[model samples]
Target: MIIFPFGKAPAVILVAALLAGGWLLLHPRGKEDANLVLWSFAKTHITAYNQALPALNHAYPDVKLSVKQIHFEALNRRLLSSFWSDLPSQPDLVEIEISCVGTYFKGPKEQIGFEDLKPRLVESGMYNRIVRNRLATWSNRGGIYGIPNDVHPVMLAYRRDIADSLGICVDSLYTWDRFIEAGRRFTVEGERYMIELNEQNVGSLECFLFQRGGGYFDSLGNVIFDNPVAVATMEWFVPLVTGKGRIGADLGSGQNAAVLFYKALEEGYYLFFICPDWRSSFIQEYSPRLAGKMALMPMPAFYPGGRRTSTQGGTMMAITKACKDKDKAWKTALFLYTNPEGRSRSFKKTNIIPPFRDAWTEPVFHEPNAFWSGQKLGEMYIGLADSIPPQYSNPFVVLAKGKLSQALVSCTQYYSVNGSSGFRDHIRKALTASADEVRKYQKRGLIE
Candidate 1:
């Protein structure tokens, strides 16, 4: 989760960018007119942009786009360095991942790196149709800097065949307590587990804390890791990995963890997954034979009827302030993110949930997902989209996530050595230490 913006360059990336750039230069299409350039870290996103190229070209006729794909960390460095160096090698529009968006939206509107997009959104009347949190994440000081490309609402994916054979009604387990009860029953024998407790990736902890209206920092820029809600969340979560309710197997990070998880998934060693819409690609690529056996459902509420969803990942389209032609840049960004036809096409191919509310009504959104037992997953995910709470956007998210992951790993080890009597205090102590660590970065003006 710590996105290092500076790193050693990869040789393959340089070669690929050189080849792609050479092709763009050799092609003479739209060379005499307005050229709108974009930069991204994903080839799939560039492919999606190509799908909308014809429509965008027909609408504006004079506008042409050239999208460049590079390393993710390199893109962050390019964006930040462009702001200081007056955008010498930057794009008119750039793709900002959710983790790095906060860094670009800092300070006053006039002093920021990106253009304020609030007026354009309000002018087109599209502001009301997009999810509020999606806009809020890329906004600072009441100025919007980006358009949300997708809404990553998280859900619980379970193996329907396993649950049914175990005589467990997934729908009936709407609360965390009920889900724990079912997990206990599912793991009565020691051959399988209910879920994998990923200590290396603390995303599940973030999801729970966000659902309970708690986060690393509050809206007022104060660290709130010591809040009662956060305490209770850790209290509830730690027990699932230790003692009697040890139904969650610990999964580490890197290729070994991925290989183990895939093996467990394929062999039916784990029965549930907590992730967002993007996880479908992982299933299809790794466990294709298990198609139709998985089913999507709302995450179990922390309390009865409480919020059941949170977000995981996102990509926002931002217009750099260095762009000379702001109007053309906005047109291209808006078309790619908000146009019904273009967004529908991307969703059909990538399974990315469109952030524009109107796009939910498109015919493609209603189509059944064959991988999930023909379920209308688009509708199910969109239903809980509005309920997602806002995260504390700050440049320190990388630091915070790293600290929390370490804390979770430490706490898990302590519980294994000791017992569950004072485990809650251990987690609270670790969180307090993390809050203090973040405070040092805040004092240094590394975050605000």
Candidate 2:
């Protein structure tokens, strides 16, 4: 069904030449960027940006932005490699998730791939407009690398239908002691649990540790995972999830973790989760049937009149040093992040509270919804957002969390064999070992 206009040999030669030319184009060693590019790993963020792109276009028709989504790990790898190589393929702007940003800080301060935004932020007077605690996570060695995307303040999301049916007042459960005591009454053998907790889930445990003025590192970047508050928290937390009467249940893992956890919640296997604001939207999407039955409250403190909130995950926007157009990149990011219209639209799409204080007064943050049993979720989140503590971002944060998880596992195993009779001393020794192990890796060079 084919006919060659010329002889078969000439036609074949023409096609081969075209193929070689295409290969050269694709295999080029280096080339100047053709347009302003933003590389983001999260599709939700991309979708939100797309929704607000028209506004961006209207504001600056001359500034063109091409948003692309790359796989999380692959993007992080490419970012570091391109940074080190100073490759032309590097994007002008990039979105760095919390877990990935720390690796960028592994090198010396001057060698960091991202631009230090402190001067720009301060000069524009926008630094004070943003939440201080959220800013801390994107900072390293006094350099603020990126702008925070959300506050990610932690709260207690519970199954209110279950609470109401059992005649329990969620508001009265204001402290961990009361939460644990209340949990024991309804946490039946297998029918229901008081909360989503596991000794091995490092991030959630880190949330608890963070709430009490304790975490993996101090302001000086030293390992403090074995600090007094952390040890005391472990002593109190371990007994709740172990033994035959455990009130905590594993939330499962992998890409479908939220779906799996929500399914279990619908089945009444669990009653609570340590919810960040972004997670509230996921709950709405994955567990739609639970609408009107769910409610959120500030996290219970260790004791009465104590810190009532914590922070978990975060993301940041940065302009890579490889960029040739820092001015245009900054304009684009500021519009996408701080503009009132974009902030409102982005929050509706993702339920991620904007970290900028000016945007907090938006109408969306004050709206009440039946989804959360009429709780003004955004207002509550913002009220606690300013109080959310600082977590020092570091290369060893991930390693420290992993080591702490291992320590928790060791404590659980020891408790299984010996019970809680001597867990206080045992946990202390285990955490000390964990801190020592992380220190070993901290001394080793990560990139070399």
Candidate 2 residues 285-400, lDDT tens each?
88889999999999998889998999988899999888888988998999988888778877777778988998899999989967899989899999999889898888887788
Q: Return the TM-score for candidate 1, rounded to 2 decimals.
A: 0.89
RMSD (Å) of each candidate, 1 decimal: 7.5, 4.6
lDDT by candidate, in order shown: 0.80, 0.87
Off by over 4 Å in 2: 1-34, 254-257, 446-448
> How does each model score on TM-score?
0.89, 0.91
lDDT of 1 by residue, 1-448 (tens): 5433554365557668999999988985763443878999988898888878888889888788887887999999977887867757768999989888767655544668888889999998979988887786777767788888888898988888887888888888899888888888787546788876765468778888888888877765677866788778777776687666677765667669777887787778888888688776677678888899988899899788789998888888889887889999988888787777777777766677887787778888778889889998888888888887877567677788888777777777877778676888888898788778988877887332
- Model 1 ranges with Cα > 4 A deviation: 1-34, 105-109, 188-190, 446-448
